[model samples]
Target: MGKIVWSVNFTLDGVVQDPTGEEGFRHGGWFGQFGGKDLDEWAKALFAEALGTEALLLGRRSYEYFVARGWASRSGEWADRLNSLPKYIVSSTLEEPKWSNSTVLKGEAVREVSKLKQERDGDMVVYGSYQLGRMLMEHDLVDELRLMVFPVVLGTGERFFGETGDKKPMRLINARTVGDSLVLLAYELVRDA
Candidate 1:
């Protein structure tokens, strides 16, 4: 069985809007704002994480945005792995996804993901799809929560963890600094045995 690993770059205040600044968000590219050699090196280290990911799970908007934006134009082994990896996009309206190795999952988000976790193997990562990731957490379908916490906080923006009513209990699995400014936090959900 596969683990649904929810991963995102978040502000210390929990904002997870547009980290790349491509979406024209007012406070976009918060991750890139920290300009330093340490930040550059930290970003380069993410390639290993991409290589280790078994598959990607995306929400409709994020899936469409990635397909039309950077990921479609990017190249090399990193791009190869990303583009070639199986992507399961949760979107009721998206009947046909144009990206290669992409599937549009039109079923109920929680049910589809629960089924996927049972059927697939290895780490299935959800990157930057806030709504989909949120739904998974609400359903108790997520196994791990991995966050790259940026030093800066946007007082107003779309939050990574909105008002999801579940109020889950999580145990800290790992916590470490990524660069001079950012910290990586990994948490495993605490479930009843």
Candidate 2:
């Protein structure tokens, strides 16, 4: 079976929105609010991991946002690999995808994802799909979580884990601090053991 893994970047106070200053909310791009050379390499490595992902799960908003960025035009080993992988978008109103290698979930996201996990394939990675993450968590579909915690905090904005009434508990699998204040935290859902 495959794993439903979530990889996301968040602020110290847990905000996960507009870390690149290219979005709304006035004050954005908090991820690079403070910077260093090593940090760049770390970010690159993180994105490289994402590129190697076999499949991507995204919400309608994040899917549209990413597709608009011309990810296919970017050139690199990572870009090539990322553009080649399959993407599943969870949406009701989105009738079509502008990006290549994209597909819409035909039915309930939880059921579709559960079936995908049952298949013999590679990791099903989820990036920046905050609302879909919450829904998956609610349905007990997420197998693992990989969070890159940045140094600063945006006093108000979207968060990594939203309100999902206790569908399952989480167990910390591993954790480490990278560079000065960044933390890499991984957790697994405690379904049975």
Off by over 4 Å in 2: none
The candidate scoring highest on lDDT is 1
TM-score of 1: 0.91
Q: Against the true structure, candidate 1 has what lDDT?
A: 0.85
What would the C-alpha RMSD of candidate 1 be, to one decimal place?
Answer: 1.8
Clashes of 2: 2
Please give the distance, in angstroms, between residue 110's alpha carbon in candidate 2 and its true position after superposition.
Answer: 1.7
Candidate 1 per-residue lDDT, tens place, 33-141, comes to: 8878657756665667778889999999889888877786689987888888999999989987887889887887788888888999999888888888888888898
> How does model 2 score by TM-score?
0.88
Candidate 1 pairs with clashing backbones:
none
**How well does candidate 1 score on lDDT at residue 127?**
82
Error of 1 at 191 (Å): 0.7
